[model samples]
Target: MLLPTLTLLTCFLLIVTLLPISNHTHWLIRGLDFPRLQIAIAAILLLIFQLIVLEITRPSSLLLICVSGFCLFWQSWWIVPYTPLFPREVKRAEKNSQKPSLKILTANVLTPNRNSQALISLVKQHKPDVLVTLESDQWWQNQLSVLEDDMPYTIKCPLDNLYGMHVYSRLPLTETETCYLVEDGVPSMHASVRLSDRVRVRVHFLHPSPPSPTENPESQERDAELIVVAKSIADSAQPIVVTGDLNDVAWSETTRLFRKISGLLDPRIGRGMFNTFHADYPFIRWPLDHLFHSEHFTVKSIKRMPSIGSDHFPLLTTLVFSPKAIPENEGIDASAEDRSRADEIVEKENVSKSEIPQPTAHAK
Candidate 1:
C-alpha cells in the first residue's frame, strides 16, 4: 500500500504537470498565442521526470511509469514547433511631436461567461479609443450597449455562436471591411480610422479558431490566414495595428515569423509575457491574447486586466505613435532567404496532404 500510494502520488504530480502541456497543445492547435503555457509545461515535465526516477522502483510500476513517460515525452513534440527561445528586446522609438495618434483595446469575452459586470467595469476603467470584442452574442451586445454613449462609433455583429464579433471606435471610421480569412463565418474586422491629427491608421481585429476535430481539420487554414495578413501588412506603407485574441502566444515560432514577415513589434518582449488565458487557473495559464504593431508606434505600457468572467483575462495596452525611424537592426528584417524559407514552410503546412510536423528526437 505504501508503494502503491507513492506511485499514485507520483502519477498525480506527473498528471498535474501534463495538464498544462495539454492546454498548451490546445492553444497551439487553435492558432492562439500561448508560449508561457508551453514553457510552464516544459518546466513541469523536467521536474516530473526527476521525481519519477527518484520515486518509482518496482518493476511493474516502473514499466508502467516508463510507458507513461514515453507518452509524455511524445507530447512534447507538439510544443516543439511553437517554442520561441530567442530573446527579443524592446527599444522605445523616439517620440515625434508631429504625428497623429490612436489607441485601441481588444478582448475576447467568452460568450457563456456571465462576468458582464466585470467586463463593463474594465471598459469603464480603461476608456480606450477603440474597443473590439470576440465571442460576443446578442446578450453580450445588449450588455455592452452602455458604452455606446462614449464609444459612439461602432460595428456590431453579435451572434449566438461564440464567434460573434464587434468593434467600437471613438475615432471617425473612414472605412470598415469584414473579411473572412479562413473558414466561413469566421470574420476578421478591418477599419481605417482618422486619428486626432487627421492621420489614418489601419486597425485589424482577428480571432481564428485553432485546428481541432470539432472546429477545424487542421491548423493550416488558421496559419495561412495569419500568414496572409502578415503578407498584407508587409506590403502596406501605412501605420498599422493588429489586435485581438490571436489564439497564439508572443514567443511562438508562428508569431515570431508573423512579426518578421509583417515588420511588426511586440510589446511583451523586454517587458514580460503577460499570460492571459485560463484566468481561473493562475498556475496553468498562457498569453493567448495579443496586440502587434508596426514601427510607427511605441508602447507606453501593456498589462493583463483583472479576470472578467471569461477564461481569458482582458489585455490593455497604451501605445504612443512616433514617426521616429527604427534603427536598421532593431526592427524585423526578414531577408530574402528568410522570406523564401518561411513561404516554403507556410506552403507545406497549408498543403492538404501534409501532416503536422513531428517533434525532433532532441525535443523528446
Candidate 2:
C-alpha cells in the first residue's frame, strides 16, 4: 500500500511541475509559476525515498528515479539564480562608497487590513526616501497623511476596487504621470526622481492584477502591461528603477522576458529569494514583491520588511547610483526572437480606447 501511494504521489508531482512550461494564459497553468520552489523540494524528498525503499534494479524503479530527477533539475534551473549559489547579478555597494543613494519601501497593505499604525511605525524606523502603498483606499490615505511632513512629494490614487496606489517621496519628483496601461481602474505611476543635483532616475511603480479565480481568470492583462513597460524602457537612455508587487514571480516566463527586453537587473538574483507573500502562512510563501533596476545602479541593501497587516511583507531596497559599474554588471538582454515574443504578447491583449482610464486627481 505504501509503495503504490508513494508512486502515485510522485507521478502527480511530476505532472504539476511541467504545467508551467505551457504558454497558455489560463490561471491554473500560470499560477503554477509561483510554487516552483515548493515543487522542487517535494521532488527532492520523493527522489530520496525512491532510492531507499524501491529496488534500484527494477525497470519501474529506474524510470521513476529518472523522471523525478528531471523534474528537480528543471525547477532548480529557474530558482538557482535567486540563490547565493549563483553569482550576484547586481553587485553590492562598497563599504566606504560614498555615492548618491535612494531607498524605497513598497507594501501591498491587503486593502482590508486596517492596522495602519504598524506600517507607519515601520516607515519611521526605516525612513525610506520613497514609500509605495498598494490596495490603499481613502481610509489608508488619511491614516498615512501623517507621513507627508517628511515625505513632502506625493501622488495619490484612492479607490475602493483594491487596486488603489500611492507614492510618497522625500526626494523631489518631476514629470510624474499616473497610467493605466492595460485596464481601467488599475493604476501605475511613472516619474523622474531627483536623487541628487547630478543624478536623476526614471522610476515606475506598478501593481498589476494577479492571475487567480477571484482577481483575474487569465494572465493576459498582467503579461501585456509588463511587456508594454519593457518596450518603452528599452528605448530610454536614463537610469531606471521599477518596483511593486508585480503579482508574478521573478523566475516566471513573463518576468524573465521583461528583464531581457528592458535590459534591467534584479537585485534579488544571487542574494536570496526574500519571499514576501502569504505572510500569514509560514509554510506557503514566495517572493511576490520586487525591485528591478537599470545596470547604472548597484545594490546597497535589499531586504523583506516585517509584516504590516498585509498579505505581502513590505520590500525595502537601497540602491547607489553607479553608472561606471555598468560595464561590469551587464543586464539581461533580449534577442531578435525575444523581441518578437514581446510584440506578440502586447498585440494579443488588444487594449481598447474605452478601456483606458481617465486622468486621476492627485494630492501633489
Candidate 3:
C-alpha cells in the first residue's frame, strides 16, 4: 500500500515537473504520442491507484507537501530554459521589397457560442486579408456571411457539431478542397491562392479533435493527420502557410516535429507563447491555436486577440515572403539534419489509412 501510494505521488510530481520539459524536447513529447486527453486520464489513474493501495497518513501528507514544494521550484527554473529568445541570425529578406504581405486571422468560434457580433467586430477591426474559423455551425456561418462581399473567396463547412471549419479570403482562390484528414466528417480545408503580387501560396487549415475518452482514446489519429499535413508541406513547391486551432500547443512535441518536418517557422517562439485555449481562464492556459509558415516568408507580427465567445482566443499573423537570408539564431535552422530527423519521425509513426479509427456519433 505504501509503495503504491508513493509511486502514485511520484507520478503526479513527475507529470507536473516534467510538463514544462515537454516544451523543449520534441522527441519525448511526440514519441510518447498520446494527446493532452491522456494527461487527464493518467491523473485519474494515479488517484485510483493511491486510494486502493495506501491508507492516508501524516507521513504521506508530509511527502505531498515536499512534492508540491519540489514542483514549485522545478517550475521556476524549468521555464527559463524553454523561453524562446530571438535567434540572432534573423536577417531582412532581400525580396521583401518585391512581395506583398499576407495577413491572416484565425479563430475557434466555439459551437453554441453566440457572440458572432463580437467576432465580427474583431474582424472589422483587424481587416485581415484572410480569416479562418473553427467549430463554426450553420448559425455561426450565417452570421459571418456578411464578410462574403468583402472577402470574395470563401470555403465553408459549417457543421452543427464542433468539427465545422471555414475559410474566407480576400485573395483569389485558385484551387480549394475540403479534405477529411483523419475520420469521416472531420473536415480540413486546403487551398491555393494568388496574392496581390500574383504569387501563388498553398494554405491548409486543420482542426483535429483533442484526445479524450469522448473523442479518440488514443492520439494516433491526431498525430497521423498532423504528420500527413507536415509531409505535404515538405513536398509542396509553392510557398505554404498552415493555420488553425490545431488543438495543440506551440511547445508540444508534435508541433515541434511538424515544424521541423514541414520546415515551417513559428513566429511565436521568441516573440511569446500567446496561450489561446480556455480564453476565460487566465492561468490554466496553453497556446492551442497556431500559424506556421514556410522559410520563404518572414513574420511581420503575430498577436492573440481579445476573446469573443469561444474557449479559445483568436490569433492574427502577418507574413511577407522575402528572398533575404534569415539569421541562424532567430529560431531553428531548417537544416538537412532537422529535416531528416523530422522525416524519420513521421515515417516511423505513419499509421495506414485503414488503421485510423472512425469517430463514434457519441464522440462527436
Best by TM-score: 2
Better of 1 and 2 by lDDT: 2
| Tens digits of lDDT, candidate 3, 1-364 | 6676566766665675565454333433442322332343444455455555555576875565455445545443322222355432223334446567789999999998999998889889999999999999899889999998889899989897699998988887766878776777788888876765556677888898765667766555666677668766564545778889886666555676787666677766546667788888775677788888766677677788998978989999888766353334243436676566555544655533333222111100
Reference-based TM-score of each model:
0.73, 0.95, 0.74
Over 4 Å off, model 1: 1-89, 93-101, 335-338, 341-364
Best by lDDT: 2
The lDDT per prediction is: 0.67, 0.88, 0.68
Question: Which residue pairs come into collision in candidate 2?
Answer: none
- Candidate 3 segments whose C-alpha is farther than 4 A from its true place: 1-11, 15-98, 326-364
Error of 1 at 358 (Å): 36
**Which pairs clash inside model 3?**
87-329, 87-330, 88-329, 89-327, 89-328, 89-329, 90-327, 93-324, 94-324
The better-scoring model by TM-score among 1 and 2 is 2
RMSD of each: 8.9, 3.7, 9.1
What tens digits encode model 2's per-residue C-alpha lDDT throughout 197-274? 788888889989988999889999999888888877776667888899899999999999999988889999999999
Ranked candidates (TM-score, high to low)? 2, 3, 1
